[model samples]
Target chain A: MIGYLRDIEKSFPIKDIGKRRQRVLKGISFEIKKGEVLGLVGLNGQGKSTTIKIMLGLLRPDRGDVKIQGHKPGEIDTLRHIAYLPENPWFFDNLNAKEFLYFIANLRQIDKERLKQEVEEMIKRVGLSGNEKKVIRKYSKGMVQRLGLAQAFLGDADFIILDEPLSGLDPEGRKMAKDLIKGHKKKQKTVFFTSHILEDIEQMADRVLIMNRGRIIKEVHRADLYNKTLEQVFIETIEHDRNN
Target chain B: MIEIIKLTLKEAKREKGFYAGLILLFLSLICYFIVESFAMFEPEKVMAVYALSSVEGLSIILLFFLIFSFLSQDLNKKGIEYMLTLPIKRRDYILGRFFGINISVFILAIISTFIYMLLHLLMFGVCPFAFLIQLILLMALVLMLSSLPFLLITASKRPTLIAFLVFFIYVIGINLDDAVRFLSTRHGREIPVVSRALLKISYYIFPNFSFFDVKIPIAYKLSFSTMHIVFALLYGILYTFFILLFSIMLFQNKEIK
Candidate 1:
């Protein structure tokens, strides 16, 4: 497995208020195989993002173990092989898109010779070619998302995790994002992505996991997706879990 | 680590506040020259005291604002997630930020010193070597002071709270000696023993910023020893290291939600 979460649990402390703690994830367990596109689907406030964070080491699990490539999450060596795009991607406002890409490239330790070429190629690949010089603060929401995609896909990361990668995209942009994930699939890269749009998951994910109220209530395979509409399955699963 | 440091410096350079602070420092220098040009007694001494103190004070304020704003932007805007997602360690992130701010502040100090030297030469026809040395020492002190805000930022997520905590610490740190002496003296005898003990303990708990203040000596052009400077330099290094270590510890466990 490229990624694994075993009985992961997380809770956030609420300060200066009556509420003491809010539990966000409850003993979630999952695994990601190499070269597989795994889709995590859920409504707002389910543990989808929390699980992604644990895998990316952004938020530590309050209980249980998380590992990437057999190393603990947040280990430098493990992160070297992974790339992440947050739900609401925010870049440094002061940096232009190219500069931001260069920054990420540098962090990825891309060689000086290939850095410029790779950044430019990624910019073009994300449909951000001409606007690379503009500061990120001036970019539109869709443009920022494009830049986020560009950064996440840059370099030779073996694993990619995207949180709501299609949130702010126009129809064309969304198609491009889907195509980009398809390209990653062709490259045999392990990808874990979360999205509200079931169609996106249907088109890209080899397997989908349905999360509701901090638990992975069901897992559906690509073969099953062919038998039933993902929207129906998602609605029924969430409704069934809520009813129980 | 180098990449993070470089990125931080680039960000700092692009920030309007960074340039604004430098401009204000220059304006203060110009104002000092204008004001001291009219002083009746010991104008050079007055200029040295005014210029060095102004530089030190402004540098601290600028650095405080810079650190607070940077951390605030990272937290509120989720820029830190970008860094944390990379192959960088949490300790490297803290150290990179600390060193980046330190370099920027050092550059500002150097610029201020250059202008001060030029102003002094124009007025007194001599570059005050002792004052230059004093400013260098102050730069070391400023570097040490920069770590405190990073430590506080790592400990707390709220920028306003961090600002207030840092300001509170600054005030207490600078007056720590006086506070400690008062608590140990007859004036503090009226207070309860527990309260007095707590006050004394607080003194040791907080950093002694007064050690960095060399204004009086620099103003008088006193023959302060090299040994003291060396000791202060060493102290500053060790103190900054410990503070940064604590910050890394806190940041390593910080959740980016």
Candidate 2:
């Protein structure tokens, strides 16, 4: 955080949040290190998704910039290191899981032989083994989430951005995702993740960046000092801001 | 680039309804000839026109289905967001889709061309080489026009209305231009050559489906001036490239938030 202050500073935009015309993401920004995971926590309209979009270069901030690996986010070369899971990830439904992965693996321009191996490993890791041959549309929501998680693991990009990766997952699926995220940490990958589930953020994120009304309001990092659940911190932070 | 194309092709194959439309188009070609058998105009002449026009007309109709099928498949199946997240640029994405559809449409054109020729040979006993050439040229023109609406609709946030407006304006432009020309002819003090040339040029530039109408002796067995096919094909391709460049420009600045 000490060396990377400039990263967040550069990423922060200056526009106001709620004016009708100019409001995709107003003045929201932050930075996390290569080995650090930053969990974005906020309510529905606070613009958590929009912030992620900016970081992924999916959306351009009207008044500021977001840099990934010292280059502007969304540039195709820089995006090679970034993996994203949307709020609702979409896949070719008729394609079986394996077929879908094979197709994406090519688009990512991963080597064909190596992609074959990686898809197998990722599916197994995500606990979607033999069902890999089944069409995606028939899968349960939790299974779909698992599929999305496995895809994020593909290409082996350095930075993985996931939005609500655990939202539709059942308890077991969520637990599996937590372990998978920790595994990403062990590999020294920088993870930018978002979720409304505070406890998941607490359990997974090394630090938390809280967004409010399209701006980043606070950063929570004290050695996971309290180790309080993300729910506890989110509530305390939002309520604290209200009272203040 | 190969990845995007491969994905698009796989998607098209997987959608049965797309192939179903292709089948229906084939049937329509045969039915067009059958109806042409009974036209009040010379059977040979009328059928020649319908044969060329029918292929182009079905193409125009089927093209809308292709756009709807592909676009809705992505949006409904959630596959589009996945493509967006990939390392491919949006320009490549758009190009890949257009090329994919182009290949599909070209395949159908080949089949329909074959059917029209076989019938022409059986009935008239001589090939409609000119009709075939004109059909090929017009196929390129109609296809570019078909692609423009989808591009605009997809590029804009409001796809449906924009697509409808795009098709309507083009349709009305062709119809109204000829209607005005007819009115000028009836009044006797006809529109001036300069004005007529201007209108024709606009029609030429504005996706003129009339160029596709091969309704005369030139269309049956004789060949056209080489200039016509070359110029028209060039015009259509250049326009398609322009529309694509425009779409890419719009997409590049769009905030995906």
List fnat per candidate, in order.
0.86, 0.62
Per-residue lDDT tens digits for candidate 2, residues A57-122, read 766665665677776776787667778888877667768899888876776778977988999998
**Per-residue lDDT over B37-73 for candidate 1, one digit per residue giving the tens place of the 0 to 100 score:** 6888988888888878877877887788777778788
TM-score of chain B of 2: 0.79
Q: Tell me how far the alpha carbon of residue B186 in candidate 2 is from the true structure, in angstroms, after superposition.
A: 4.0
How much lDDT does each candidate structure score? 0.84, 0.71
Q: lDDT at A231 for candidate 1?
A: 95
lDDT of 1 by residue, A1-244 (tens): 6878888888887764576888888888889998999999999888787787788888888899888988988889999999999888888888899988988898888999999899988898889988999988899999999988988899968999999999899988898888888888789888899988898898889999999888889999989866789999999999999999
Which has the greatest DockQ? Answer: 1
**Prediction 2 TM-score vs. true:** 0.86
Docking class of 2: medium
Q: Report, for all candidates in order, the number of backbone clashes.
A: 0, 2
Off by over 4 Å in 2: A1-26, A225-227, B29-42, B73-81, B122-125, B150-155, B187-205, B215-223
Task: Report the C-alpha lDDT of model 2 over B164-214, residue by residue, as the tens digit.
Answer: 766775685457557556646755247677866766666655665554444
